[model samples]
Every structure is written in structure tokens, then in C-alpha cells.
Target: MKLIDLNRDGEIGANCHYIQIGSLNLVIDSGLHPKKAGRRAAPDFGPIRGVHLDLIIITHCHLDHIGSLPVLLREHPEAPVVMSTSSRMLVERMLHNSANVMVRQKEEANIPEYPLFTHEEIDRIAKRLTGIPFGQAKRIQGGKDDITIILHPAGHVAGAAGVEIHHKRRQIFLTGDVLFEDQRTLPGAKFPAGRFDTLVMETTRGITARGSEKTRLIEVNRLIDSINDTIQRGGSYLIPVFALGRQQEILSIIHDARKFRRLVDCPIFAAGLGMDLADYFDEISRKTKHVRFNRGIIKELQIKPTPRKLNPGEDPQQNGLYIISSGMMVERTPSYTLASGLVGHARNTIGFVGYCDPDTPGGELLASKPGDQFLFKACNVKTKIKARVERFDLSGHADREELLEFAVQADPRVIVLTHGENEARAWFAGQLAEKLPKTKLIDPVPLQTYQV
Candidate 1:
């Protein structure tokens, strides 16, 4: 079996992998980088552009994992796309939102190729999608070989899965952003307890061991305390969250906190694609029993949608709790716009609930001290950091120790790490070497093929 990293950055951004097993050629994911723009954001598809891929599997609907899917489908229209049923619904909305964002960027940023793929193109790609329920093994003909693919629950998002491939006598497992611990909305993964020859895993949180010491319950309580304190001070709170998993998880946390009286009743506002996804989460949870979220919570809590644009002097919603998207607070996003209106006021609080790219606006804001002056290039505005800013390690990824434990249990002869930066990978490499000295750990060089 040969594996190649298609992403230019070996780290988290633009995650994609090409796997060649005997006669079978498959692309794991085709994603867009959050930090890059235009073609640069997409994975390096040039290497496998003309190759005949037998199958394409998307593990989840996160933009980093599925963003450039339409572009890839346009290039390889014959390949069948496979993902969870929830991902199917979520990806469609995500791609449409992506296209709209690109169009807006074209008008505002003057990028000629901003809208890399159109809604029409996305529609065409959607036709090829095949949603498979978890735990079912499907066999497909790969040239002269029969390949069996099984998707196990990943517990990362509403419908995330870890893919298992069986070819002949060999088995390979590709963990696409897995989480072993349960979130408020989703349960933990239940992967088959067995060994594989090759284990390709993500090392997204390898550099941070902090999560290992803190439980999700602890983090959730801390978040509730922060919100309560902010609201009690006659301040509003803003949570910039990822549209898919984090938004739902945080909403559940807030809802439960209010029910227990840990948090005061306040007007809850949400905007962006996450609101649309909440309906899907509700449907899937009811149908599949995959998530703990209820659509009724949205209505019961009276979550209102924030206007697309808030006026400059619109007095910080007066003790409202705003859950907005563009988790990284990307420029022009609803979170960024709302934050711009709220940050200048000392009475408001901007809370970060998940991972933020260090280079993004959200990360920058987290690093800034109170009373610091920061410039938001997207809105071409500068504001004082009078609003309280706090970040909780409410990460969806499994803790480093959990990953180490999983890897040890998998007991693969060859372990290849991806989806983490150099520091993170290096840390994992050191840990794995000490614990499993006999195993070979490989950090993939971008575009380079490795035979296992």
C-alpha cells in the first residue's frame, strides 16, 4: 500500500490524502485551507488530478476536510463520494455557504478566482454523493480487487466517522479527526477493538496536553461560570463557534446551564449556517439516536437569529448570549461583525469555545490583553479590547493521552501522523517512540509517497 499526502501543509490546514492499494486508488478528503485564499486554499490535486480514483470518502463536513470537494469532483466526476447521512446534508449547506462567501470575496477582495466552484457545480457534485450508515461494510470493485470499506463512529461531530479499509488479508485504518470522549451532543467513538497493519491518524492536539488534565464537564462548568459572571455584570456574551459540532455542543451546554440555574435566563441569539445545521442535527438525533441534541432546545430557549448586519452603535444586545459562526472569526463573518460592535464596550464578553487557528482573528484576540488596541482588517476598523475575552479548551479532538492510548491499542506496525503542525507531530513522535519502541512512526512529507 502506498500513501501520499496531498496537502501542501502537512499540518491541519487543507487535509487530503491519496491512497493506492494494489489496483485501488482512493482519495480520503479534499479540503480547503482556512488561512489561504483562491487556489492556494485547496489541497495539491495536481499529483492525482488525472488519476482514476475508485472511491472518495469524506469523514466529516468540516471545511478543512470537505471544502474543496466540489473542485475535486469537477476534476474527477466519475468517482463516487461517500460520507455519513448527516454529512451529506451538512456538506451541501456548507458548500453553498462557501460559494456565497467566495462570491462576496470576489466583489470585496478583487480575487478573480474567488468562487472556485459555483453552486451549479456543487449541485452536480452532490448527485454523486452516497450516504452510508455507520457500522455497515460495503464492498466495491477496485479494478481486479475487492475492497471492503467500513465507517465507524468518530465522535468528532454529528456524523463523523473513522474509515476502515480491508483489502485481501491486510487492514488499514484512517482516523479522520477522531474523538474518543463524548461531547454534549455526540457520544464517544466505538471503533472495533483490533489491530491493523497501517494506522493513519490525525495529530491535531498532539502539542497540547492540557486537555488531558481537564474533563469536558470541567470545561463546560467553567464556560457557564464565565457566561453567568458576564451576564450578571449587565454584559452580553459572544461565543464564536464552528457551525457544525461546537455550535451545537455549546448550545446544549448553555441550555442545560440555564435549566440548572447556573446561568441567568437571557436572550440567546445565533446566526450563520449553524442555525440551519441545528435542524439537521435535530432530525438525525431523532432518527439515528446519534446525538443528544434536541431541536426543541432551540425553540424552548427562544434562540433568535441575529440580523445580518448590526449597526455600529447598537448597544451590545443588553445581556444577550450571542452564538455566532465563522469559529475563527474570519473577516466579514457574522461573528466578526458582531464582535466589532461588541468589543468596544467594557460590559460585553467574547468567549472562544473551540480551537482557533493562531493566525486567525479569533486567536489574535485571545492573545491580546484587556485594554489593548487591535485592528480588524476585514472591516477596516480598529477597536479597544474593553470587552472581556476568555478561551476554554473545549476542543472536540481527543486528548493527547487518549490518542496515545488508542494508538497503543491499535498496535499498528506503521503509524503515519497527519493533521498537525511540526511541533505537534514531533511531540507525538517522541511519545510514541518511548511507549511503542518497536513500531515505525512516519511523519509524511508533503506530496511524497510512502510504501507500507
Candidate 2:
């Protein structure tokens, strides 16, 4: 079996890899890297064009992982896009939302069009999606000679999974994105109770430090308390959050804090797609009860006004709590505009809930000199430095220590690391090398094929 690299970079519009093995072709996550000028750099799929894809598995609903599903399905309409039932539902929502974001980006950037496939193509691909339950193995073909596959929970997102392929003599485990230990949103990935010939896993946070979930919750609550104190001094809280995991997790935590009276009442403003995405978490909370919903329950939270669509010069209510998308203020999404409008306001606090790439505006704020105040260009409000900026350690990906433990548990003959920048992947590889010297570790370059 050979593995092909399809978009090795962390960002979409970058390079991508596609794999072909025997009569079966499997395409993992396909995405592009964003160009320097904000255009998407499409990956080359010429190598796998003629090959028939027996199955396609999506790791999670993240745009970088599922962005090119439409592109792939548009070309190979006969191939079934296989993923978890929950992922199937989530991706359908995510992909459609992605199309809307792309359209908005084009209009905002004044670009005539984005080269990515249209909404129609996304719908076509969505129609071909086949949902598989966890632990159930499906045969790709009718005969014994065909590929056999199993889906296991990766514990990254609600329905994220790892794909295990049993083909003749070899057992290959492809961990899409796993939460090794102490994950708050979902359970840590359970190692398959068997050995494997080759293992393909993503190293998104492989080189970083991750603390325990309990510790993180404590720290996050403390930070929220400090911010709330400032808010009591007439400051508002601004959180730039993604519409997926982070938003839901933060909302739940804040709600819980409110329940225990650890946090005070400030209107919780969930803006843009966040308001809609919270529906999923609310459903999860109601169905599972595993999620904590104290006082600031999402279903009870108020919806903030869409300031962008409002009259050009209108300001959002400046007194309560608020959360918006584009967690890093880099994307021209609502969160960015909100940050620009609220920065320099002495009566507000901004808290970051997720990892912001160094180039993003949120990153800039986090890294900025402590004494420096952020400038705002939108609302033209230059208030005092009353907003407190802090970061919480509620990361979705597993860190270095967890990665080593997970690797040891899997105990594969060979390990291939994907879905990280070269530096982080290399660092993770070095750690893996030290922990499991006997196993062969591969750091794949884009489009490079590997045989196992």
C-alpha cells in the first residue's frame, strides 16, 4: 500500500496528497493553502485522476480537512464519501457555511470569483455522503480481495474518527485528529486493542504543551472571573471564537460558572454563525447531560445584532458579554470587525479561546507588548486600556506528552505524521523517535508517496 501526500501544509490552498493502493484508492482530507495575496492554491490531483476511489474518509468537519470534499466528489461523483453519522451532519452544515464564507470573502475582497467549486457542487457531494457507525467495518467491494475498513472515534470533535484499514496481511490505522488525554469536549481516543503494520496520524498540537482538562477549567474560570471583575467596572467581554468546538465549550463553561455563582451576569452575546452553531451544542447538552450548563445556558443566551448588516455607522450594544467567530480577528469575519470596533474601549475585555496563527490579528494582540493598546479603525472609539487579554488552555488537539502516550499504546511498526507544518511535525517526529526508537517514523513531503 502506498500513501500520497495531499495538502501537507496546515492552511488550505496549500499542497495536498492523494493515495492509491492496489485496486482501491483512498483520499483522506483534501484542502488548499491560502496564497500570499489571499487566493487559494489548489493541489495537484493528476496522479490519482484515472484511479477509482473505493472509499473516502473525512477526519473531522474542519474546513481544512473537508474543504476539498466537493472538489473531489465533483470529479469522482461515483465515489462515496465515508464518515461518521455525526460528521456527516456536521460537515453538511460546515461545508454549506464554508460556501457562504467564500462568497462573502470574494465580495469583501472585491475578487470577482473564488476558483473553488460552487455551492451546487458542495450539495452534489453532500448527497453522496454515506454515514458509518463507529466500530462497524465495511467492505469496499463485494469479494474477499477488496478493502475492508473500520471507523473508530478519534475524540477530536463530536463525531470525528480514525479510519482503520484491514487489507490482507496489513492493518493500517489512520488517526485523523485525536484527543489523547484530558479532553473536555469528548473522551480521549481509545487505542484499538490490536497491533498495526503502519500508523498515519496528524500532529497538529504534537509538539505543544497541554495541561489537564480540570486544571484548564480552573485557569479559564479564574481568567473569566478577572474579566468579569473588569466588566463589573463597566467593561464588556469580547471572545473571538470558532463556531464549532471552542464556542460550545466556552459557552458551557461560562454557563456552569454562572450556575455555581462563580461568574456574574453580563449579557452573553453570541454573534454571526456562532448563534446558529450553538444549537448543536445545546442539543448535545440536552441529550448527553455530560456537558455542564449552569447559569449562562446557550438556549437562554440572547442573540447579538448583526452589526455589519446594520446601518454603516451603528455600534453594537457596548455593555454586555459577546462572542464572535474568526477567533483570531484575522479573518474579515464578524469577530474581526467587532474587535476593531471594541478595541481601545476602556470598558471592554477580549479573551482568546483558541489557537491563533502568528499572522492573525488575535495573535498580534496576544503577542503585543503588555503596555500597548490595540487600535480600532471601525467604530472610531479610543477608550482606555480597561480590556483584559488572556488565553485559555482548552486546546482541541493532544499535546506532546499525550502524543507519546498514544504512540506507545498503538505500538505500530511504522508511524507517518501528517497535518502539521514542517517544523512542528519534525519536532513531533524527534519526540516519537526518542520514545519509540524501533518504529519507523516518516515525515512526508507534499505529494510524496509512501509504501507500507
Best by lDDT: 1
- Report the Cα lDDT for residue 42, model 2: 47
Instruction: Name the lDDT of candidate 1.
Output: 0.87
Model 1: per-residue Cα lDDT over 297-364, one tens digit each: 88878988887667643455658899988788888788887888888888898889888888999999
lDDT for each of the candidates?
A: 0.87, 0.67
Residue range 83-120, candidate 2, lDDT tens digits: 87667657777777877766776677666656366777
The TM-score values for the models, in the order shown, are: 0.97, 0.88
User: Considering only N, C-alpha and C atoms within 3 Å, which residue pairs clash in candidate 1?
Assistant: none
Candidate closest to the true structure, highest TM-score: 1
